[model samples]
Target: MLDVLRVTFPFFALVLCGYLAARWRLLPLEAIGGLNAFVLYFALPAMLYEFGAGTPLGQMLDPVAFTVYLACALLMVAGTVRFSLNERIRWNDAAFGALVAAFPNTGFMGVPLLVALLGATAAGPAILTILIDLVITSSLCIALSRLDGADEHGASAAARKALRGMALNPMPWSIALGALSSGLGVRPIQPVMATISLLAAAASPVALFTIGSVLARSQIVAAAAEHGPMPARDFVPVAVAKLLVHPLLVLAAGQAAIALGLPLDRFTLSVMVLVAALPSASNVSLLAERFEADNGRIARIILLTTAAAFLTFSAAVALVGPRG
Candidate 1:
């Protein structure tokens, strides 16, 4: 346990620093977007490209791992939606809540953290979860949010928009291009690779810090507004779902897959479980606000899961990490 804490402590401490920076106005709220942009567009993509370029494509996109992880993710979506829906049956809040629960912060946090705890080899499954959550889990929840409106056109448009967003996402493209480069035995000029190496190195600590800054921004903004008192009944369950239920679901699902004679490797399964254990994606608050959902509740869930994850995630790693 102490060993696990040593591995996990610095990661969460960066988060704490970001939170304090935002709370103390060391990092302005508006500047949070630029910080996040630097991570998403630059550091993270560079890291993904490097990982994809070096890793065997087959090992990264294992069908068994993908299937088990996706199945558990969908189950999380359905369960969260069913549990968190209000008496008004607002599909928008319910759907976004489900998304917050189902979608881990895989991009910003999981890829680098998992690799640190596991190994460079763990990068494949970590990136694979990004594809599952970014492309599949996010799109499905967005679509589900439209169901209550019965606007077939809206749903179709949302689907198109989701696909378009995926098309434009640099992470998946980086992975693909990296894999292709690896397949061809091609190497970039040392200067270009050196630039990528610099950015990739910045990814872990910066991304983790950005998560705290975003969380702090959300908390301050939500407090400033009259978003009404959060219904603990509504949001607390979703947080629990993300932190506790989701990882356990993945564990069971992975075991089941293995029992069924699938090729889901233990290392990939462990990575999937840890990814599932991640706190809610911070961007869900932004998405909820955009869609006119209850951003306050969404933010609360993210905050709750993140604060708790320092302990819970460490325990999870202690129990099931590579060292185990």
Candidate 2:
């Protein structure tokens, strides 16, 4: 619909701009990391903090929404792992594939864009999705990745490392502080709030642009590398799982929850579905490279879902969107 397009076009256009800029060397690939660091370390945390602090803890995250979304993510992980693991592939590749299929780019893209489309209140559910992905889904997938040939030490080590990384992550900490502030009625002083406001305002455009640049950089790197034969089967199905299947699972599960008489917020359910509809988390490519999985396949899936989400995600927004 024209109405939906009007809401989504600029966000996707910024993504295209970032993609073009990186491809054209306007944003050198080396510099993409720094831009991402800025968003991750500064802009995004502040944005989450403000949203968390301003919202009532109840509205900040719906328990029913969390359970439903988590269940959907777990289901996606299991399903993708089952589907992707075949003759050649092992748990490492399939686990990361499952991760890509389960994790959406909620922090970098979904929070800001969804809030813009739906309003500030959407931030609670959007941020809640980030917590689920970072804390549970990613950790579960990475732990599963080591299941191929690892001893108990290696497996436990991988899980510990994952939890440690989550502890170091600033986004979750900011969300907690924000919730604490909300809980205790602790409002910030004018200047501090103003700084957070500015950073939060910058979060959307910068994060979106960085997502485009990261996708471009990944593609550039993958193309330059000595990539092995990547059949469409290896990547395409996983990409489809991310852009299409994940959201559908969320929708179906949430609807079922509502039928079961759970207290799921209608707007929260819509936000959760849209968040699930977002492309595979771009950072999954980095995780793949880190764990020595097939980065080529992971990057392709991220790129494919991101590019396709321009259409699929828009349609999803229109379908579940509040305005509609």
Candidate 3:
């Protein structure tokens, strides 16, 4: 319907324009990196602080919904790994594949879409979803790194590495600090809050646009070199899990939350489902590249799923229906 397209088109348009500009050599590809850094470090944190500070944290923090979401994600990861292993894919590939399939584009795609379609009131669930993605779901990426041959660092070293990796992540820092400030009732200076609001306001459009450019780049780079097809042989099982199984599990989990009579607001439920429906995080490719996983193959999957998201996400929204 027009309502859905109205919500979606601007986001997609921004991305399309950014991608074309990048392809035409009008914008440096490195700008995407810089933009991502700015959004994560400054813009998104400010947004979280401002938005989270006003939310009734007690109301939104539903243990039932949280548990259900995490359980569903973990189950999907386990199932994907098992299926990939059965298919004879390397353990590392299976792990990475599981991660890519399980993780959603929550920060980049879910937040903005929820904001536009659902409104500012939706920020509570959107921010919470971002925290979950950065803190919990992304941790799976680190686990996958181990499976992918990132050296057999001891458990302590692995713990240290995961901690170090998490420390540098601006999303978690922002959310943790923001949540604490909210809980503690710390009020930022009005002017400072305003400045942060400005930056945060720009975060979604800029980040999503850059993601579009990055996806275009992924497709281009993936094409010139023949590493294998997108739905790669080894990655097929993972893709199937991502495109099908994960969402089903999330739906079941969400329905359970509904049945439990949790106090989730309309926006919160909507955003949570949206996060559940998102395609793979763009960060998966970044993680694969950093850990020296099959970067080429992962790049293709990112593009493929991102494009596939147009359908999957719409279907999810339709299935979940409008929030109560």
Candidate 4:
């Protein structure tokens, strides 16, 4: 409906603008890294911190929502890994494939998009999902990828690496600091809050634009050609898992939680479903390339799912009735 379009157009349009800018060489490809760094390191954390500091700690730590979202993600990862094994893929590659299917783009796309469609309150669950993906889901994938390849030492090393990476990530720390401040009722000086507000305001548009630029530079067509004929049998299912199954699972989980007398409201439930419905993170392709897994396959999957998400997300929001 036009109402949905009015809510959703700017997000996709910003992406299209970034894509066209990159395609036309209006913005150099190298510049996207800087933009991404700005989003990841500075803007997003500030936004999350602001949200966390302002929200009630109890609301921020919704146990039922966290458990359901994480359980669904783990289920998808396990299911996809099994499917990959059945298809004769290596364990490492299969693990990466599982990640592609399970990891939603909660940071760049989900947070801004949901907050815009819903409200600042939506950021709480969105941040919770982000933390779950970064800590539990990613570490599990890394462990699985290494488990079959090496002995005990390799598994330890992989675990250590995952932990180290998680430690270095700024989002968790920002969230923690914000939660601490909120719990202690510690308010920032007006000037500091003002600065954070400014940075937080920039997170959505810049992050969306950077995503578009990344897509333009992904060279998905070239990767598909070089990788040979589409692995339709494998790729189609993973894409479906990411775009469709994940959200449905979240919705079902939420309903189950409410049935059990958990305190999930409609708006929060809608936000969780919307966040789950997002495409796989672009970083999944990077992880594939890093581990020398099926990078081309993953890249193509990202491209297809991201393109398809526009309609799917719009439909989801329409159906969910945007009351959040």
Q: Distance from true position, residue 63, model 2, in Å?
A: 1.9
- lDDT per residue (tens digit) for residues 1-324 in model 1: 898789888988999999999999999889999999998899989999998888888877688888888898899999888877767548888999999999999888887888888888888888888888889988988878877766667766777777887888888888888888878878689999999999999999999999999999888877787546765787888899899999999999998988998888887888888998989999888777777777778889999999999899988888778532
Range of the 10 consecutive residues with the lowest summed lDDT in candidate 1: 222-231
TM-score of each: 0.96, 0.96, 0.87, 0.92
lDDT per residue for candidate 3 within 221-321, as digits (tens), equals 55676554545566555655676677677666677776778654544555666776677777777776666556666776666666776777776666664
Per-model CA lDDT versus the true structure: 0.86, 0.89, 0.69, 0.82
> Per-residue CA lDDT of candidate 2, range 1-324, in tens?
678788888888888899899999999889999999989889999999998998889876678888999999999999999998888799999999999999999998888788888888888888888999999999999989988855767667789889998998999999999999999999789999999989988898998899889888888777778446678988998999899889889989988998999998778889999999999998888888889888888889998998899899989988889532
State which candidate has the highest lDDT: 2
**Local error of candidate 1 at residue 241 (angstroms):** 0.9
Is candidate 1 or 3 superior in TM-score?
1
Compared to the true structure, candidate 1 yields what TM-score? 0.96
Q: Which stretches of candidate 3 lie over 4 Å from their true place?
A: 86-88, 148-156, 220-237, 257-267
Instruction: Please report the TM-score between candidate 4 and the true structure.
Output: 0.92
Candidate 4, superposed: residue stretches over 4 Å from native: 86-88, 148-152, 220-227
**Model 2 misplaced regions, further than 4 Å:** none
